[model samples]
Target: MSSVGGGEECTVTEQQLLPPPPVPRTKMGCSWLFSLRTLAAGFSLILAVLFFHPSLHSFLVGSTDPNNPFLYVRNFHVWTRRHPQKAQDLSMGSRSALAATHFQSKQTYIIIHGFLGSSTDGWILSLKDALLNREDCNVISVNWSAGSTTAEYFLIQPRVRTVGAEVGQFLSFLEDTAGLYTYQVHVIGHSLGAHAAGFVGKTLNGTLPRITGLDPAGLSFHQADSADRLHHSDAVFVDVIHTHGCYTFLKMWEDCFGIDENLGDADFWPNGGERQPACEDGGDGATSVKDGSSCDHGMAYVLYIESIKYMPSSTHFLARQCPSWKHYNNRSCPCGHPVQYMGFNADPRAHGVFYLNTSRTAPYGLLDSDCSAGAFSLVQIIGLMMLSILLVLLLLLVGLVLIQQYFGLPILARVRARLYMEDLVWHGLGKSPSTHILNSDKAVDT
Candidate 1:
């Protein structure tokens, strides 16, 4: 070897070590990320659906089960002067059983109670007695208490139509068997029962002579279509008593335990149809009188009962036609306006909205026009305005907080990041590859 010149220019092998090949992206990782994004999206979609369609919640998860056969059974307890304490059961399926009882062919009055109430409630019994004393007519108490009392309010609401249908069928049976005219029938209902009575008139082809709704329920039926809830067209004469017509907390609009809309031929609004004096908060702003807020709701039937019991001396409950309660309070109502009784003696011939005042205690009817009870002080008006504004702001703040919380989730963050990368890629693909590469390099460098 010519090793004499270069000291062991020995063979040295230089092996260039290339970096280990990048670990191939795992399918499991990509799949897990995709699944998480899909799950979050699906959950948000479901929440959105429920937020928009509220009735579906009542229909899908109602308080009463439609499959239960017991829900269909409705009992009509018939009482008269001949059988005052003892009520004979009248069934839709049976004819002879009802005929053998003390069923009369006189003016028949049907009394129906609301949610969580029974045919045997103290008020119901008292009403039955009062009606019997007033005349020798038949007093029928509808007993759907089994179905109406056991379920949640929303659950029982839809079943009111069923109750109405059953009562209508029974009335038809009376028409065929007892030879009774539809005009001779008068239906009186309280709260949810009032709407049920409306359905009854609908079932009878709007032939019922009278329908009296005592504080008809407002929750589900407030915005309902005319055909679905109590309406003036449901009967020849419909009289509505709005005692608790507007909930206090919801004063921005009329929403209450009792329906606020004038759904009858004669709409009687007592004490401005919002809160009763007897049910108002005491000076402490914490204590309520009598049955609390329910005092107002119950006053409708109480006033009706008084009208029936003291018919001769019941002129005190008389109401005057006015455009609004404010006008009535101001005594600015035009002279020669129509006037009507507020309760049981409400004349079918008289029509339009009516307003009246009542005492703060039982025997509540006022002797004269006293709109003093409805006048609002300047302080009260300012307080109410402030409260409404505060409530609106609170609701908006809560909504924003919820939205921020929802979007701040780690999964949501991952989804957003992935979407952003996809967006970049999509727009990049729209441009020339060289331009994209240049822009990306510039971004990395910056």
Candidate 2:
């Protein structure tokens, strides 16, 4: 307090001299971070349901009924050298389909696609084009998408068998009606379609000349009996290309989306039959999440396509009859072991679990290496270590950001409160915590 000469009094307190306190902080709640995470998780779950629900249904509810009315061959798009760009749609056992084809004793190829696949897929189209380029052969692209896809995926297996039977019946009809030989046909299938091809062979008493299984699906078929899946005995010559091999969750390092077992007379494991070079790293045990598992699975047909396209070139993939990829890596296979060409030109006589290496991109085949095991170079190892470390750091940083968003940056709050409290307490001065300054300061400390 102070008195002036004119008897006027004026007063000023320490509180008034202090700066105004900060506004109380609002409690953090779920924000954009939470919504984003929830959205991502929901999307991933939906994808998993769509991809695995059918397989899960098959596994839990076994398919005992072989005759499913819903499953049937929708159409067979027949193509020849004359009609390479366009396909002539044909119906099963229809004389029109047989007559439309320019089949003059040329090789007949039946291309089948897997679950949720159509005859118009890129690989199927490329394969059809290649086959036409190779010779004046009869190329039939089977569109059984209806049977291959359903709301209840569990029915796919039985439906696949039904479609296969229908295809078999159609071939038999061609045999009787158009003088075509069923034994001269070459059946090629991918994933579920591979097993359909097997059923086709089974219907004909295992008389088809060849059946190629491209990265056959492993979900429900991995442990299936020979009769239930594509088997070596399904055809006279069955060559399987295993780009993505299946491994249990415990063996996540050997991750893939396709069956790894030897289900054919000749089983070729390119890039160790598991991970491919072009896919994302699986160091975090998230092969499906990180890599999408497409590169490995799709590489099967890519290799086959190249095999057909580069038939005359030395860049074609050559494989060795080794017990396993490790043996091939160590060059431990017996000297007397036979060398085999993989893909479209695979020799029927060379039958075994063959292993080989491939490049990272297009033109995947190596020129001439006894066994390029695809071992990581020193630079690659260093790069992989850096990637792993970076991945860990990135995960940690994300965790911190989420925490800050929810908890209001606990570390920073604590530091600011300590400094403010120390300034007041050390100066031998204290204010009511209810004051705007103390409330705002304590909110951070709390």
Candidate 3:
């Protein structure tokens, strides 16, 4: 019995120690799966690189050094009609040159461009020409392309506050050394630059005369507090033009460019504030940002340029205060109220939302010959009254037909007979000959 037990244990140990048979290897299937995974990983990496290129490049090459004012703040290239061909580099350190320069005590117009813009842009030059043509004011085109031209909008946003401080300091230097006053300074900014101008005004403690925000930027600042954005208190008078303010649930790339809030004393919403005439839709916000299809966003400055070109003329581009675009379209608001002109001629005292219609092409102003003329004419009123009366009579006839249908035609017949008898009695007419014959026949039958 001891020998048998030992033999069984030895057999079990041998079976446990024996090696298993080799499994079949599917090299082709394994290689195919591995190749597919490698290809998918490579594609995903490429997409990630493409998507993060802008931010990465901004981080690498963007001016993050706070001490280097030249890269961030001193890049402002000042341009005037006197030197339209050249630009003057103004910085905090260079006080002697600015003091001896062509800046006078006259109204100084500072034009600041939005994201990815330059001082030599065609619109800037055009605006400079228009302003110089109209008045003898000093036009300074604030060019901070060093900070503004970055592909990453987020990277450039922080630099705007610094640029504004630099600009405010520069304005102060002008007051101290160049004989320019804050009241004489009018800063006109488009898009992101508009908020930068607000920063400048805030830095100056709201002493600046006026700040014209041409569609102040909506992204990163739309829902920001008043301290962070362009508020009416930023300057003595603030006027805003909402040309590309898009309010929708799904904000496309191009749609989120301009703020819809009224950040100024007077807010002008031209053509309902989103779609402007003559501006073909540029697909979406991303496409517009890439292809420069920001016609609506740029229209604010265009309208402003036109206004400057034709100043002090109350006839062109007349705008009236309205509760909404609906009221403007319906022409329900009485025209007898005092009118305010949009753009450069906008009254500083004008306080509220103003509405106006513009043409699809250039010279966009709608001419108003008479301010007191009512929207509806006498003939229109009479026609409307007649149509209303006809509608009421038709409704009454329909009601009567419905009643007769529901209550039976016999009831209607009886009502008509009773009405006829009443009319005869009221007229004092005796019974007809037919009735008398019928009565005699009845008496003979009886």
What is the TM-score of each predicted model, taking all chains together?
0.63, 0.63, 0.66
Return the TM-score for candidate 2, rounded to 2 decimals: 0.63
Candidate 3 residue-wise lDDT at 196: 87
lDDT of 3: 0.74
Candidate 1's C-alpha runs over 4 A off are 1-71, 247-255, 281-293, 312-314, 334-338, 369-446
**Largest TM-score belongs to which candidate?**
3
Best-fitting candidate, scored by lDDT: 1
Clashing pairs in 2: 54-153
Flag the better candidate by lDDT, 1 or 2: 1
Q: What is the lDDT of residue 199 in candidate 2?
A: 91
Residue 227, model 1, lDDT: 84
lDDT (Cα, 0-100) at 222 in candidate 3:
64
Q: Between which residue pairs do clashes occur in model 3? A: 253-285, 254-285
Regarding TM-score, does 2 or 3 come out ahead? 3
Q: Write candidate 3's Cα lDDT for 104-123 as tens digits.
A: 68888888888877766777
Ranking by lDDT: 1, 2, 3
> What lDDT would each prediction earn against the true structure?
0.76, 0.75, 0.74
User: Distance from true position, residue 390, model 1, in Å?
Assistant: 69
TM-score of 1: 0.63
- Model 2 misplaced regions, further than 4 Å: 1-70, 147-152, 249-255, 281-293, 312-315, 334-338, 371-446
